[model samples]
Target: MADQDFDVVVVGSGAGALLGAIRAQEQGLKTLLVEKADLFGGTSALSGGGIWIPANYDQARAGVRDDLRTAFGYMLRCVRGMASEDRVLAYVETANTMAEYLRSIGVPYRCMPKYADYYPHIEGSMPGGRTMDPVDFNAARLGVDALETMRACPPGSKLFGRISINAFQAHSMLSREFKSRFQLIGMMLGYFLDYPWRRKTQRDRRLTGGQALIAGLLTAARKAGVQMWRNAPLRELVQDASGRVTGVVVEKDGRQLQIRARKGVLLGAGGFERNQAMREQYLTQPSRAEWTATPVGGNTGDAHRAGQAVGAQLHLMDWSWGAPTMDVPKEPAFRAIFVERSLPGCMVVNSRGERFLNESGPYPEFQQAMLADHARGNGSVPAWIVFDAGFRAQNPMGPLMPGSAVPDSKLRKSWLGKVYWKGETLDELAAQIGVDAAGLKDSARRMTEYARTGKDLDFDRGGNVFDRYYGDPRLKNPNLGPIEKGPFYAMQLWPGEIGTKGGLLTDRDARVLDTHGQVIPGLYCVGNNSASVMGPAYAGAGSTLGPAMTFAFRAVSDMLGRPLPLQHADWLEQPERAAQRPAERMAQAA
Candidate 1:
């Protein structure tokens, strides 16, 4: 090997890049993983850590009969032309193989049996088991590598198996009088404990979905002897006159260094979430400030820019994996509001104080609604998620903001716990929040009435498998509870995201294709850096990570020209068994 050369050079230590590097190493290739941040994990460590893999190995073994045609059909119908046919088909067909390969390599995974695609009501949607999440791993097991990378489900985000907010409310609504009171007290105690714990822990460490995935992958990568260079941003793709990518010009420690790639170069540096100009032009929103939770410094668009210079075909430049966030005033980061989408019996209202869309619907749908609001003269301003006192008592708001966190001093003055409210009565609350009091009162009356009848006449919210899966089965009304109580609370929500989903186009084999649709020899892209397989819509929990890992596995397989064998197939087949194994031994010595 030369002074700075490897068989593969992977830009960005995201899940996709990590998987690609691992695969390349397994193929007897010397792989180098470079990241722009001091930490190894990229935006992936800041995500929900779910991977959407229809008819995956775990699902198949559980006797779920999802096929390639069905999965592809579902993707097409759900994405509705937002995703290319070839890309969708490639993801569906290779999803299972990727899942199997990762399991064999010792990445602990569990099928989220109750989760579904974002739009299950659409034709070809699966009922359950399409998404997968990483099995919980001990951070201590990561050793020195743990300190070097970010962990998903960071210490700040974990709740001790707490259900979604709506689920808790439904449970509260259905319990007997004595049971309800006891449960309320218990819930309050749990909340208090978690609140203090989260605050104290956050000051020291953050735990979240991204943290979990990165920790697991980093552990595996370290054990496999893969060298990861942090704060080394790939400046340009170095290619020979033959049009073959041979190396990269990276700026590390303020010096430009040429790192050669002998086998291939994989671009998985993530999307352009923090690129204000791109966000402004492509997203059409004035404020790009609420775009993400990952470190804002990594949004230089290095991967996209580098790929474009080499004629890599770009796809879905105008798309994103959408999320709702709360602009935490003075804080440097936005607060992600999971309850607004995951919690039932809540409604989102724009500045005009009218219901926009189904609050618990797919995130993309919510984003589209928000974008429409911006188009109608509301550019990412304050949006309110209004729910009743019933909701306040029953549902758990994960974190509370101090007066210091709020941007507006007046808004901060009204904070009580994690909720913001200004009402002695329902009408008063409505007026305080600047909504039409009469209209809000009327809407609440109708929704509460429907809860008694166990039906949502307006949005058909709880009628589907997807909605019901996230709904609390304890309540007869499921998603139809009324917000009629006095002292209604509103939590400000913003348009945020896990990561951007548009970048270099690729074939099913994960090879980077050019603008003319020709393969960019010795180049590949996977994960969030590549256009999503599901297209504009997000599926269930693990959709993002699943495809990222799958494509990475496929990219390596194509490079190596063969399937890698597992050390222990039987143990790998069992979720508990696989998750319990030591991280150091997860990946076998190549």
Candidate 2:
């Protein structure tokens, strides 16, 4: 007996949750979507909206060849025993299927051919074409009311905190290509000339990145007849006498409402990054809730708590989707330093003013190194990105745009001392940022020589193809440049994350697994609420959203009593065979 009944109860309004609801509703399940926040989209909307799907149709159409063997090999190396073999196999097998299914529902995506896999040197890694982004969506299609309520992307994802641009456009503009400059000009003109839409709302009609991805799925969900409820937070999971989940008690308004789901309750409500207690208890020390780039109060682990209360097992509690972040004036959460640290003419250093790891590597690896360095008593917790005026003139770092585009003179006064630290010399800049002056000067001199020689002698910054992806292509080594110009700048860097990677552990079909490794009937988990299929390592761009949606699709299939076919079932049956090295797996795949 319940106050409300639905075939499927989907908790959270992120991309994964919405996809599950849409799939269930379209299949005649009568799905109800719930969100804790009044706003619809979670961190997904505020993200860059990249999805890493190996062997996707978009890649094949573009003449990029990929196979399960290679993708699996790459995953095995990346996860390094952190993730289960079955889950990893399911991801490689069904990710493309998930993309195709979404495309059939009118949510098309474009392949980013130039966005290489995060670890190019690893076995089975592709130089490019594994990551893709949604085609820019027109939010106007959802109408004004829906658009207003939906979460908007953060200023970091937008151009000047207004105009939206896709990943391709971002790459082109960051590279400062001639055609992209013209395209930017045209885009600005189009945004301003949107007529009645502009007059009615300042929100850009064109949505890009995570907003575009969510908007497309949102539109499809609406068409599929999925009922949505905002400010409906899951209070607890209701299990019957047999220890089987039957429904969920959700808090709506000021009262609790029991919602029975005939099929299952899918928890995609994201991770516990916002929970300061959880962060200190699980994550590396020196972490803070305010350091996370996730929406404020959006991901306080409601789903995690709910799932845990019902005998669900948790894994990867010590990891997160790590990124180097910085504080900005009046911004609720920290702004991530994506692509900014990789650009030419800038290097991150500890308080002792020394480089510990390759600054141009994947962001997760970057933060991992930062934390490791800090653990080694190097005082790297609050590191700084030191750069020259030449670097500032050519590139954008965090909230500040390129000096050529928006000079320091035009900057908001509050941002100067807080967001940007400046000095006329290396020693002066080091002093201003509380860094070792001698070490800073030596590192800068060494970096300048490395820039000249087109090689990072100490750390090999631009040594890999992936490292050069977001770098300045105009230079000999896009990631190597001198910090020689006067008025050098430094910005404090924090070990910020998009979300926590730890949560309820689920099986290959996305069913919540209990402490004893048995599936808990009628309880499914996806998104950050579940332990990531990729484990502690980032596979590529869109790694977060790609697996989230793919597993959600699999979860829906399970809920409908028709599980998606598992790839290499015969191989997976034998535990001994599955434990073989990746080379053997690649041989079997061949």
Candidate 3:
């Protein structure tokens, strides 16, 4: 009924949108954080929570070195002609600055000291990565009302209800170390204890990883007094006579509300990953909204459409941070095909029962190989992950976890089937999974040879350190384990994305630029809604997140006329000193 005006109006409630809102609020701007869905965090809540911030203080503090030239060399080698020099330079420069700023505002994170770069062979890459994610946050600190409204991590992604685990923990859960085993026992105890309570409460609140990342920000936002509204979809950009985006028109609670943004409207909403029409228009291949890893009704390009309506230029509109995924009836969403595909006893084969790319390659590179095969002849269009019973008993595949019996409800299918299959023999597995029986058997025979020799003459399955990260260290050739153990299995994989990385064209400061390369005042973009400064290359664990945060911080700084507040782990400086009482400290000094 009444026109609501604010200093800044942000669309989408992902990390980028929330970061902008938090910054705006901290800077004394009346900021509004809006999400189209009922949830607070969008795709960000579903992520692995790595932010690739090269040359960061966390790395330095951890005794891992990363410099400007090294980061520059990596970007130069990877990005190529995909993005502007200024944008890339700004990202590397401000990554550490942004990290410091967020810490000041109460966001916490630990450095991933051992996580290597995805493409470490490239120039200027650091084997020890610069990625970081939010440390664990307590949901009780955010209160029950806010916790209930936040999005929950998909069941397939979580190990124990809502109990989120980090990458190190994920890989080391069953480690041989006594401490690790003790921790594993503790984790299981916690899960069993909390699982019943979670069922009763109807909410998964033990946030970790990406969920923890957003939860930390939520805590910060609450402290900063930033107001948030869920289920508010942007309908149009409210532009002035001079073609300046002054505000936004959002449909909230079935009413059209015209909200004025005094400084600007930042479109950190998202890319077109969840919009089937846009995906079809931009992509040459067939992909649907259901195929995307983003939330069901979220990120349908409503914000991007509003920006486009106001003549905002879109760049690399069809790009995304893709991974191999398979959807099952048991899980509500497509589950990311993670470490399972690279285990010793596993092999990914096309329809002809032929091996394509290195099954143990980086997920994005694996995606390109799959797409290339599909584009050529649909060879990998419905590729199957062929593995043996030994593999099945040792590792998890997509929806199937280790040690859990394969669900028998819908297990059987014909030779031309799509989803999954299991058989007592390689030929039987091949026929049930729909691949050339001879081709599969012949490949299995050769794979057995390769497994013994620890050398794959064909695709080099376990060559790189990055590939080895997903494999078993116990094996001599971890990624080259034989598929001789029967009965074997086959599960199909589809190309899916963490999220799209292309949208509005923005400059170094994150100001949305037109086709003529002129900045449009009072308009900015970040996250996937803006063309990624890192371009098509996913360099490390948190490359997408790291730059998303950096660019969003830069955009906020422009809006507020000041750099973000610099905060550090102040308590870590002298923990015992902080614990001591103020009067007691004076007495002790005396």
- TM of each candidate vs. truth: 0.82, 0.96, 0.91
lDDT of 1: 0.67
Off by over 4 Å in 3: 160-162, 174-179, 193-205, 404-419, 562-590
**Between candidates 2 and 3, which one is better according to TM-score?**
2
Q: How would you encode candidate 3's per-residue C-alpha lDDT over 491-529 as one tens digit per residue? A: 888887777877888877888877656778899999888
Model 3 vs. true fold: TM: 0.91
Candidate 1, residue 471: Cα displacement in angstroms equals 2.2
Q: Please write out the lDDT profile of model 1 over residues 217-322, one tens digit for every residue.
A: 7877877888888878888998889888888989888899998898788888888888887787666464474556556687557788899899987777777777
Error of 3 at 396 (Å): 0.9
Kindly provide the TM-score of model 2 when superposed on the true structure, using C-alpha atoms.
0.96
Model 1 CA deviation exceeding 4 Å by range: 1-3, 60-63, 82-84, 151-156, 160-209, 329-332, 377-381, 398-419, 561-590
Model 3: pairs clashing at backbone N, Cα or C within 3 Å:
50-542, 52-542, 104-567
Q: Which ten residues in a row have the lowest lDDT in candidate 1?
A: 581-590
- Enumerate residue pairs that collide in model 2: 50-542
